[model samples]
Target: MIKVVKFGGSSLASAEQFKKVGDIIRKDETRRYVIPSAPGKRTPKDTKVTDMLYHCYGQAILANDDDDCEEYQRSFEDLIEKIKERYQEIIEGLSLELSLDEDFKVIKENFSKKIGRDYAASRGEYLNGKIMAAYLGIEFIDAAEIIFFDEEGNFDDKKTDEAVAKRLENLERAVIPGFYGSGPDGKIRTFSRGGSDITGSIVAKAVHADMYENWTDVSGFLIADPRIIPNPKAIDVITYRELRELSYMGATVLHEDAIFPVRKEGIPINIRNTNSPEDKGTLIVEDTCRKPRFIITGIAGKKDFASITVEKAMMNGQIGFCKKVLEVFEDNGISIEHMPSGIDTMTIFVHQDEFEEKEQKVIAGIHRAVEPDFLELESDLALIAVVGRGMRATRGTSGRLFSALAHANVNVKMIDQGSSELNIIIGVRNHDFQPAIKAIYDIFVNTMI
Candidate 1:
């Protein structure tokens, strides 16, 4: 069985880390295609190679106009040397007869020309891929050749898939840099940060691999943010839909968009840790017949939300009432997060930062469109999503949730559950966010255990 493995920056941070990765790959002959990210922070205080590239590029941009151009040039040279040293250290540690001199010369020339930040950011993965390929004695395939983007800078999925499939079909093993592709103009373009995950998924789909293994610093995704819930339980297996709910609510391990490409092909993604290869990490699949271990799969939440409540007698009776109110938000370009309603009241939840600038306009639009008798706007609200497929089979999940919060003296402002019974959302005051999560976790995860 063929496997496509993608290693995150932390997994390839240092030569020591690279040694660990090399062992993992060598042990698994089926792992033919490799995707790698730039070197990440080796320690808590260390800077990432990507960030250093950005800084160096930024310095190059400013050197053109600086009064002390000579000094600025010297600084730029220093930064480039540091980046080379990072790669050189890895090469020396791995005992590889590889030289990145020509690559660095080209990169320095590009930086001098101010060839866009995307190009600057992409060099991290590009350079790392070269090192990875040499260390493994495998062919190096530049992602720009296989991944395609449209003129608008959006990924061209069909083109990318077609190109990647044809390119890798004949190759037994290759290393493709993650996070970058070529646009219509043949200029380098990058995805948002942490896009290596998306690259892995794309390669997995193109190759139709049996499984996609994502190697990172963490063994797997945790039930809750470890910072919020001390030593949170690790999720062994999660479905695509369930992961979406948790990711949307703020549980981040895998990139949310990464699930799409593999999901369409019904490919399963195994999130593994490089440091602890023996431990089986979280498995993300399209669907599963296996029952969840807990009543709820995971809980995640976000803070700084504002709710606008439109109350009018017989409001539910009026046709297009909700539509008109929603249109007002749509017209104002504010994306509504949630809209839970009663017979006479509808509360529109939105990110506070997005709504603040156009608050008066939206309020006025609501007044003219819906003509509610009372309109109240509240802010500093936090939304928590308790998601699980098991909740559908088990009863009193909501009762237990509310009971836990009440016992913790946390007041719930709003509650919304999807028709799928897959997840429940509860809004609480910003201050209660941590406590609310703790209470929910204790009830759903701890009590169940």
Candidate 2:
């Protein structure tokens, strides 16, 4: 069995932290393949090394106007030197001899396209991978050599599959850097934000990893936000659909797009805390391998949503009513979030900030265009998502959820459930986010799971 473990920056922040990481991996022989991120901040006030490099690259491009090339070269070289210095310090602190001098290749001076921020952001993983491989006495495989993109700025799945299969099939135990890959033009390219997570997932899938562990600072995903619900229970196991709903509503443990590759192959991705490995972290998978235990798994919510409720007799049956209503948002360059409708009324859910200055104009436009009987705006709205896989086969899940909320004396404002039945979203007052979350958690996770 093979395990691909990816350590976040905070997990590798200091030599002490790196020691902990080494201990964790050594304890489990299956954790043979490792992916290391650039060292992250040890404290709140610190800045990430990747951010510094991006700024240096920005300065390099801005000052290339002199034509003598010294300014650009010096600026770029300064960033490169800083990268090397960071690794040097880590190696010395850990009392390890890392061969980064040969691996750390400088970006060519006159290269016209610097490959955008992806290339700059990806160097963090590259440098850390170099240090980690040396510390572990393993080979370092550059991700740019394996992950590929087309000339038109698209991911080449076929090429990447072949390259990763060929490469991993040959290596026994190695560290592969995450984030940037090579495009068809043979330059560094990257995916969307959190590309390192994407890269790790790709590697896990390629190697057919038994499990993919993501090590971060936090213990794991909670059933609800602690800020809203004090000391919410931690989720030990969650399904892919349930996690997607929680992520959509502000869960931050795992990047949403990072789950696809592993999910496609039915591989379980574990979100664990490097600092406290003994704690059971969240296990994300397709479905319950054990049993149907709970009616609901987690609750998450976001604040400051504003809703515009429009009411007119037979509004759903009216000709061109929806088009006219949408044209007002189109004219203002605003997009509706969720539209819950009925025969007489429809409420458009949008961020409060979006309608800050244009509420009056949008109202007037709707008055003249759609001619609704009444148009009113509700602010300070918070949306909560109650998600689980068990609810799919369980009857009265929604009824149970609403009953729980009602028992807590929390008045529900607007509710929406996807026909998929994986989750139910309820809107409440921003002031009630805490009580609502705690109330739901008491009924669902604590009582049921």
- For candidate 1, report its TM-score: 0.98
Extract clashing residue pairs from model 2: none
Give residue 449's lDDT in candidate 1 (0 to 100): 82
Which runs in model 1 stand beyond 4 Å of their true positions?
66-68
Instruction: Give the TM-scores of the predictions, in the order they appear.
Output: 0.98, 0.87
lDDT of 2 by residue, 82-103 (tens): 7667778789988996566765
Instruction: Give the Å shift of residue 323 in candidate 1.
Output: 2.4
